[model samples]
Structures are given as structure tokens and as C-alpha cells.
Target: MGGSYEDAIALLDTRRRVRRPSGALAKDAARDAGLKPEFRVGGEALRGKPGIVGMSGWMEELGHSPADVAALNIIHVAGTKGKGSTCAYIEALLLAHGAATGWPRSVGMYTSPHLLVPQERVRISGTAIDERGFAKYFFEVWERLFDGDTATESQKGERPRYLQLCVLVALHAFIKEGVGAVVLETHHGGEYDATNFVEKPVVTVVTPLGRDHVKQLGPGMKDIAWHKAGILKSGAVAISSAQEEGLEEVLRARAEERGVFGGDVKVVTGTEEPGVQGVKPDVQMGNCAVAVVAVRAFLERMRGEVLSEESVRRGVEGFKWPGRFQVVERGGGRERWWCDGAHNEMSIGVAGRWFVDGLEEGDRARVLVFSQISDSRDTEAVFRCLAESLKGSGVQLVIFTTYDPDQTFSASMSLDQQVATTTLPSLDVYERVWKELHPNAEVRFELQLAEALNLAKRIGEPGAGVDVLVTGSLHLVAGTLWWLGEGVGGAR
Candidate 1:
């Protein structure tokens, strides 16, 4: 019945000690240890467990002050996609200005489906919290939640332990590190999300909203947009990307209704005078413009503050994020690989357009190795977009692979089934229109990434332009990276 900090550490350590290295074995051990058996956002198991619907009540009970929390000077971002990239840019800008920064992002940034080491979920200044610090803070927070009680009457159906614990731990780490600015990327709808407990933020940024997480949020764009817009507070600036057709109007109306100044809500479409990076890529304009506007708004709010425009520009231009249009060079002058996390239809179309229009004729061969989770909406459309974009680009095979079966939301299916059902049909539709438009192009699909990459390497005619693109899901990119000897940081 003892629930002391020491006891909790010993318990967690014992649980870890007994888990095997293989995923299946570890899952079994977790079930045996009475852990929930279902999956959670960060790739942790939460089978048959209750979830915290909202953190508002909990934050209030803890006597946490929003003003004191705002004193940490944080920017909160929520979106279905681009949240991680945006957060990375903001963090980089703050770091360039010599401010201590803490960023908690989704999908292997802060937490992942599995943790090879626990410290990856909590970090300060790009370094994981040491084991001692992790244990110290984790137990300190856990004891407070349990109130150092022993054998208290067990609540029949209390909040699941993991979600509650993660919120407390994150808050504790942010406070302990004395982070000057913390950038948080939220999961699910913003209003009820764990991070929503914070009081009025300086600025809330929303990236483009699309059809995703339909089961949890809703089926329509308006519903999803409303959920994302939940972060906006009266008088706080709200920034968003230029929407498609009526979407922008919907957002503008919402912000107006909330009494936020009309000028405070900025919608970015494209930028003039393209800036030169080491490489020129498509979507660079949109991404850069969004980052620039958001950063400017935040800085303007702190007018008398010490942030400078030059430093902000430097931070935005110099920020680096892997697996989001990342181009890695191979040894021996082999084909280069472009890795991205364009799992949805819109993103794939954007990437395809970039490759076709940006790359020079003699630069690199474009070969796509794509895979996605089964539960993804309109994946067939995504494949079609990629194919249409690369119609006349001399692009080679479109290799199709299955994402990690363990971490995906959909039921497991064979690689062949995935290609036969989704990728193949999409390719056929793409070909029917493509052949009439351009008869010189060809598209084929393979069931394995390794084989596809090997084929691409062999098909390269020595000096011929050859670039391999691996994308679809973050898991697919992470898996390919692991095979290529790159460290999957969260997976150790």
C-alpha cells in the first residue's frame, strides 16, 4: 500500500528490468505487469485504461498560476501537421538568442511508441534529462499526486495513471529547468488536450488543418478547425496558414467572434523574393513565410523585450529538422535519399510538385519509396497526387512498404495487400490520366524499401541524376533511417 517516491522508482525499475528487447516480448511483459494493453499517442501501451478528458480541473487544484506560467514565456502550437517543424523553428530562434528553451513535440521528439531510454521524453537545451534528474522529478511529482497515502480506498474508475503522470512530469520539468521559453506541440483537439491547462499564452499558432484523426475529432474540416482553434484566447494573436477557399473565412470569423483584433489574425499564403538556402526546394516558401509571421507576431507582443529581428531571421533560416524533406548524401557517390513525413494526400502532392519543379534536369534521379499506416484517410489520393506531380520527371519506381505494424492505428495487413488495395489502384488511376497527357512516363510499385533502394542504386547510370525519396509515415522514415545506421534518438 506504500506509494512513496522511492517505492515508485523501484517499481518502474523492476518493470523495466523484466521487459525483453523484442517488441512482442515487451508487450507481453507489460500486459503481465498489469499495464494497459492499448496504444497511446506517444507509442506507449494504454490498453483498457481511462484517459484524462481534460487537465483544467487538475491544474486549478494544484494552484498553478497562468501568469507565473506565462512568465516562462512559452509559445503553444497545435496542428495536425507542420506543428513539429514550426516548433523546431521557434525553438531554434530562441536558442540563437541565448534563451534556455524546452520543446515537447510528438512522434519521437519528446515521446515515441517505445522508449529505448526513458530520458528522451524530457529534455532541456537539446539534451535529455539525466537519469538522476528524471528520477528525482518523476518521483517528486508522483508522490504529490498520490498524496503519500497508503491503502486509501481505490477509486473504482480513476484517470489512467500514465496520462496523468506524463502531464505532471512535463510541467515539473518545465518549471525545474526555468526555461525562458517553452514551445509545446499538442496532440488531438486543443481545448481538452493536456497542454491546454496553461493560462493565456502570448501567441497561439495554427498550421493548415486537414482530414485526420477523424474518429477522435470529427469527419469535416470545419469541425477539425474548430477543435484546433480552441487554443485562441481573447486579445491573444492567432496566426494561421492561408486556407483553401472557405477555410480562411471560417478561421477569421472565429477569431473575430472571440474579440481578438482583426489584424492580430494573420494568414500567410506565399512569400516574394525567394531566399536562397544551401538547396532550393518547393514548399520552402510556405514553410518559411509561416515561421516568419508567427515569430514576428510573438516578438511584436514583447515589443520592449530584447528579441531582435536579425536574430529571429537567423534562427528561422538556420533551423534544422530531419526527415522533413531531408536530403542525405550516400558514400561512394551513390544516389542521395530524400526523407520526408508526407503521409497524407496533400503533403505528398506538395512534395511531388517540389521535386518536379525544383530539381535540375541533370541533378538527381527521383525515385519514391512510400508507405503509410492503414488508418490514414485518403491514402490512395496521396499516391495519386505523388504520381501526378512526377508525371514527366523521369522518376523511377514508386516502392510501397508497410509501416511498423506495432505502432499503426489500423489493423495489420500484408505488404502485398497494401500495394494491391491502396497503392496499385491509385497508380492505375494516375496512369490512365497520365498516359493521355504524357506517354513517355512509367510508374511501378515494389513491396519492399530495401529492394527498391537497391534497385534505384543499380539503375543509376553512373553520373545520371538519381535521388531516392522515402516517405509516407514517420515510422517508415525512422525504420529506413535505422537500417541506414542513423540513430533513432528516442528508440536509442
Candidate 2:
């Protein structure tokens, strides 16, 4: 009866009064408690979002079938720009107060578009998951979905996109590692994203809303806001940074449904406070402020108390998002490489301000290394913002490059995920934008980012003020780092 599939089914059929479900089905039953029978979308009593994980019930299955996420105290965040920075701050705050709170220092987080390395998406205690750990958990998640066998090369590519799988692994690894808390960052809309499957999180935070990801999310700001607010659930504390007029309206309306608006849990809009320590260096003051409040709320949820201001301040001071406006040393510490993931107009404007503000304070040869990461960043608009933001910075040279990972270095990232690090990126579209912005502007289109970096260093003068402003796609920052022999910690 137990030896063959037919015999087992025959035995069950003869003896069974009613079939009892277990494994994935039992886990799904457990998670069914959180689901509203009539699924709602943005406060509207909608029937369902067919593709969304909330309705699909995939998360419930993922939770118990292979790993359980029920006990993980997670701080979930979704936004356009500062999601990564905000998550970093939360992790830093947790690490800073780990000993005091008796919290596990193995802080876990999952972010997207790792600057140069893929494992950077899954960090543990402030470092990328090493190759061995990543491979172990990576295949564990992968194999679980495919009946416990290694995926072929073709099957691997056909699997979920790299970011989605990385998230699954991060959640799985965090559970296995016994991490006390997790900071989950979503790369897309709250309701529709794969990471949204997280059943329960102590806190959910959103940074300032922006107009990127229009194709997938929607055409308008409100649409984007509604999608982002999907992360909100009943009885969960929610926090947000200042939003534009349209963005605020939608977010507030949705938050109202959950009784989050105008409550202590919602907190004030992050714009009112210069909440983080010193000058905000990550992306914007609003984002840093939002992170501060969100981390405080998370700490309160985890430990039933808020961390001391000094501890929070110390974490904020030391926190740095790898490719977000980071000033790195290249060329034997002589040249300054200011790298940022200004892949869109909103971020480009900020990056331009940081660069121009620096140049104004002192005289330096500032070279602009820019490229379009995706169409989400309208090339024309991005170039226009850069042109206006850096109008008088005397940017002597502009280099447009790609983020092709294969050309730069052999990375150990699973699924052979590649960045546009080589010289083959389509530079003509961006070059055309540059030409229109500065018909007389000096520029170069290189297939290899490494060549572009070498060129920038060569074209600039040797002095403290010589800055190579490597601000465009975050992938470009990672490529530049790897090209300059940095970021080897993870990809290697």
C-alpha cells in the first residue's frame, strides 16, 4: 500500500472518511486567518487582484512548506527612492542597540539592484551573504519550489526574477539563522510585490512617493500611492515620509481604512523633523527623517520601547547605503569618486545638487559619469534635470556608460544575473539627451565602465577638488566600485 502511488491512493480511497490536508495546504490554512474573504484593493472592497500574492496565497504556502516567517519580527518598507537607505538605517539602529535590547545582532534585510553584487540584496549583520551561505539558502529555496532538485541553467533563468528569489532566500535564511528582526524592502508596489507575502510585520514604512515604475504600477501618482499603501494591514503601525499633494491624498485615504492616519502609530509626516543626526547624507532630509521615526516605531514594537536618542543617533551617523551618494577613493586615494544611483529624474536632481553644492564650496574639475539604467528613468528628463541642477558646476567632461556585470568581473551571483557593466549599453539615447542639453558639452560613450572610469581620472586634474561624480544607475556605482577594485567583498 505504501510502495506505489496507485496503491497509496487506493488505500486512502477505501479507508478515508475525509482527506486531511497537510504540508503546503496546512500552512495555507494557517495563513488564511489574515486574508479578508472579500479582498480589498486601496480601501475598495475589491474581489481580487489576480496576480497579487495576497490573493494568490503563495506566501502562506511559502511560510510553512519550507520555512516559517510567522515568528520573524519584520519591519517592512516600500517606496520609490529611499527604501534602501531607510532599511539600512533600521538595520544600523538594530545593530547599534542589539546588546542593550538583548536582540540578535544578526540583523537581516533584503534590498534590490545590488550596486555590483547580487548577494548584496541579502545582507546579514551589515554584510552581504557570503557565497557559501547564499548558495546554500539560494538552492534550498529554489529546489523547494521545484521538487527538491537543482534547476537546470535554462530552468533557472525561467524561474522568478533574481530579486524575487533573493527575497525568498533572505526570509528563509533569516528564519534559519535565528535573526531577531528583519527589515524587508520592496522593489515594487506593496500589494503586488512578491515580498508582500510577509504575513505579519511589526511596522511598515514608506518613503516619499515618486513617478518611476509607471509601466508596471500605473500612470498616475495616486495609482502609485494606492499600490504602495497595499503593504498596510489592520493593527500594524505605519509611518511615511512627506508626500507630494496627490501622493499624500491617496496614502492618507488608504491609511484611514486601517485607522493609521492621524494616530500616534502613523506619526507626523517625516518632513517636520530633521530627525536624523547632523546633515542628512543618504538621499534627502525627508528620507532620513522618515527612517528615524520608522526605526523608533520598529524598536518599540520589538522590545516594547523606543531606543535611546544617542544610540539611534550613533547608528544614523554610521549608516551608509553602498551606492547612494557615497564618496569613494580611487587612483591611490588621489581622486574622489562620488557614486549614487540617480537612475531617475527625482534622484538625478538630488545627485546634481550634491555634486554642484560640493563644487561651489571649492574649485574642482567635476566630471559627470552618467547613463540610463532603464526606461523608467526617462533619459530626456533625467538629462534635463542634471543639466539644470549642474548648470554652473563647470562639469568639464561627461561619460555615459553601461552597468554590464559580465564584462567587468566574473560575479558569483546565482542565476547569472548580469548588470550593464560592459561598454555595450545603448549610450546613443542618453547621448542624444546630453547633446540636446549641452550641444557644446564634451562627452564620451564607452562600452566599458572601467574604460570610462580610467578616462575620467585621466581627464581630470590631480588635486583634492578633482571629483569624478559617478552618479547615474546604482548598478553603475557598483560597476565603478568593482572596476576600481572595490565591492569585491560580495561578488567575489
Candidate 3:
């Protein structure tokens, strides 16, 4: 397959074969594919099979096996929120400590739903993979698994889903680059996630659990916890952040059944003061605590030594994960934009609280640009949670829009996003929900993201201070970042 980076992206786009079932069919599919089944919902099922059931076959097609995956010495992370940030903290700590240990020359991290490009999903030594490297490894995997024997000019054969293909490319690139360890974040659920194919991780971490991915994981928190805890190996240490009352029991039960290190799970509460600037005090500290505990466990359990406190502090302070709790000033400090990918009901509250807490006591016009693409989510409840957070702020403008930033930017929206946008009937729900909650505030819906941002900018023109919060969906955040020049090659 002779393909440039553009060609690679075009082919990758084809993998988003959306099959969204609804009504009774959705319920029946969920019952048959979720809860008792081993595979994730909506994955292309093998004939007579429940789900993908172990990504081993896909790995073998790419010339990798369980043994190969285990060699990466992965630190598996799964949860409803903070997975990416936790992984970022872990990678930073490992890099800060690796110099002294002289063991790991490089560390690789694999996370989902990139902010700008697909290459952002794979990072080595805390840097995103460049275009050349991305295309090189992408086609290598494509040739083996997607493109059949080239000698006979056979048509493109079977292919993994878009997210599945990204995982394979990251793993292959990590192996080729000779990284000593990989911090792997679960795509969604853990039981049958493509990343769960790793035979064993040195340690397994579960961030704070909440109601998310209900279509695939649950209608309840317990159901979601069961799927998340599936990442814990038989002998690996399971580290978790403080969860709701009785939720820890669910994790412990899963650990006991999975035989994880005598069924003992370590629960950690964050430091009173995180000592990190430009980070939220409550949520960031909790995520930091989980990361610190995970790194300490990996070192003490695997290397038989404890990490230095100084290294831990430096790592935490230096950690950076874009498109989540990110702040940027544009138009010569005349306008400010706060971006966070808070998609679920639980996280929307967190994002709102953070925004409210961080606001300066000024008469700046507050504008909200938001959108949610998940049909499984309760848009009204999520908007209500946000409304509660914004009760005190004099926010009178709310703009709901699609994720596509600009119609001319062909690569702005991913294939999955395109499908989701088409499925979304309209923004009437968002407008109606805001009207019911904030009766006096104004609400606007824009089909194009560029128009939304323009409207936001116009609401708070230059020379007049205005604070804008962009939240709800990661795709929306990504587009905002592109427009704001805050991503990849863009300016801060």
C-alpha cells in the first residue's frame, strides 16, 4: 500500500462503519452483547461470536502475540474520568525516575480521542509522534492486516475498527522504538477493550468511577465498575482513587474473583495541597494521588525500590495533557478560553465547578460553547448539572454547535465524529434544556463550529474582557483548540 500521510488518514477514515441500533433493538443488542457477554457493544461481531473476544487474532494478524504485548511492561489504566491525566502523570514520573535507574531509555503512552490529529494518541518520551513516523508505522500495520498479499493485487482485506487500528499502530511503534514501558489507557470498557489484550501489566490503575458509556458498560455504576476492574491481572497490584461509598466493594469483589494479589486493592486520597499551579485543587490532586501511588507500586513491586519524593513532585508539576482543563488567552489577552472534554453528566459538573472557581471577580462577559455527541447520554441532565454550576456567574450566552470547526478544513473532524454529527437530529434539546433551567439567559445553535466560535468572539469583542468556556465533547474541544491555535504546531 503506497500511501502518504493523507492517504493513510483517508483509509483510516473508512474504518468508522457506524451501526447505531436504537429502541428495542438497542436494548436487545445491549443485553446480548453487554452485561453477560465478553465483547464490547457495537464491535463488528464474528459469526456465532458474542464480541471481539480477545484481540489476539487481530494482534496475530499484525504479527504480534500476547507475549509480545507483555514484554512492553504496560501499566494499564481504566475509568470514567482522569484516565488520560493519570497516564500523563505516570509517564512523567517514570521519565523523571528513569534517569536514576538507568533502565528505561524511553517511555510510551497510548491514549484515545486525540485533540488535533490521530498521532496525538501515541506519545514517546512525552512528545507526540511526528507525521513521518505516524505514516510509516501506520502503513506497515495496514499492509500486514488490512492490505492482503500485494503480489496478486488482491483487494483490501479485513480491517480493525478505527480505534483498534490506532492501538495496533501505537503498540507496533512502541516496540519498534524499543521503549521500556507503555502506559496504556483503555478505549472504553476494560473487559474486552482492544488494549486489554496485553497479557499482564506491572500494575493496574482505576481512576474515579462514574456513570459513563452506559450504552456499553452500564445503566448503573456497579456495572461500569465491573468492566473497568477487568483490567486487573491475577498477580498485579490494583491501585484506585477514592470512589463513592460501597463502590470500593465492587472493585474489591472483582479483584478477589480475578485473583489480584490476594484481592487487596489500595485506595488513595490525594494530598491536601497538590502544590501544582494552573491545575484544579480538588480533582487534579485526586488524579495526582492515584498516579503517585501507581508509580510507587510499580517501582516497589517490580524494582524493589521506592521512588524519590522530589522526583514525584517534579513529575506532577511538569505533567501536561492537552484538551482537558486547559486554559488559553487569545487576542492579546483580551479574550480567554477554557477548554475541557467533559462529556458525561458526572464530568460536566466537575468542569463547571472548576470554571466557576477559577473565574476572576470581574464584569467580564461569560459565554458558553458546548455540544455532546453521545446519544446514550442524558443531554438534559448534563445541561442541568452545568446550569447549576453557572448559577452565580452572569452568563447570558450559550451556543450549541456541531464539532466540525470549519467546512474547508477537511481533516478537522474524524470519521467517527462525522457519523455522530449526522445521527444527531438537532440542537433543539440543548436550547430547550437551557431555556427551562436558565429562563432569562439567551441560547443559540450553530451548525458550523467556526460560526459558534465567531459568535462567542463577537459576544466578547477584543479590548473588552470576556471569558468563554468550551466543554461537553472532546471533538468540540479539539476543534476549539485548532481554531485557537493551541494544538500541536499551533501557538499556545
Model 3 C-alpha lDDT per residue in residues 1-492, reported as the tens digit of each score: 557888888878777645643423244544654434334334422222213342567677777777888888889999988898889989988888886677567899999877777888889988988878889999998888765553134534334777788888999999889898889998888876778877778899999898877776676778788878889889888989889888899899988887887578888865543433334546877787788888888888767877787777778766888888988998777788999988877788889888888888777888999887666777777877887887777777998877642121234543333422433334676677677778888988777777788888888764468889999888888888777766474111
Better-scoring candidate (lDDT), 1 or 2: 2
- What are the clashing pairs of model 1? 36-47, 37-47, 38-47, 42-112, 43-113, 364-465, 364-466, 365-465, 365-466, 365-467
Comparing 1 with 3 on TM-score, the higher-scoring candidate is: 3
What TM-score against the true fold does each predicted structure earn?
0.71, 0.80, 0.88
lDDT of candidates 1 onward, in order: 0.57, 0.66, 0.77
**Candidate 1: tens digits of C-alpha lDDT, residues 370-426:** 676545366666666666777777764555555443321111323222232223235
Residue 159's lDDT in candidate 1: 24
On TM-score, the leading prediction is: 3
- Candidate 2: tens digits of C-alpha lDDT, residues 1-492: 013323222322232222212222233432453445343333333222212333223333354432357577778899887788778877877887785666756788888756654567778878888756766766565455533344456544234443455666677788789887888888767866767776567788988778787655556778778888878765668887777777776766777776652443353453444336355544555666777777677776667776777776667665767777777875565688887878677788888888767654565567898866564446667767887787777777898766653232344432224434334445666677666766777988776666777788886555654688887676677767766666546221
| True-vs-predicted CA distance for residue 336, candidate 2, Å | 0.9
Winning model by lDDT: 3
Error of 2 at 158 (Å): 9.7
lDDT, candidate 1, equals 0.57
TM-score order, best first, reads 3, 2, 1
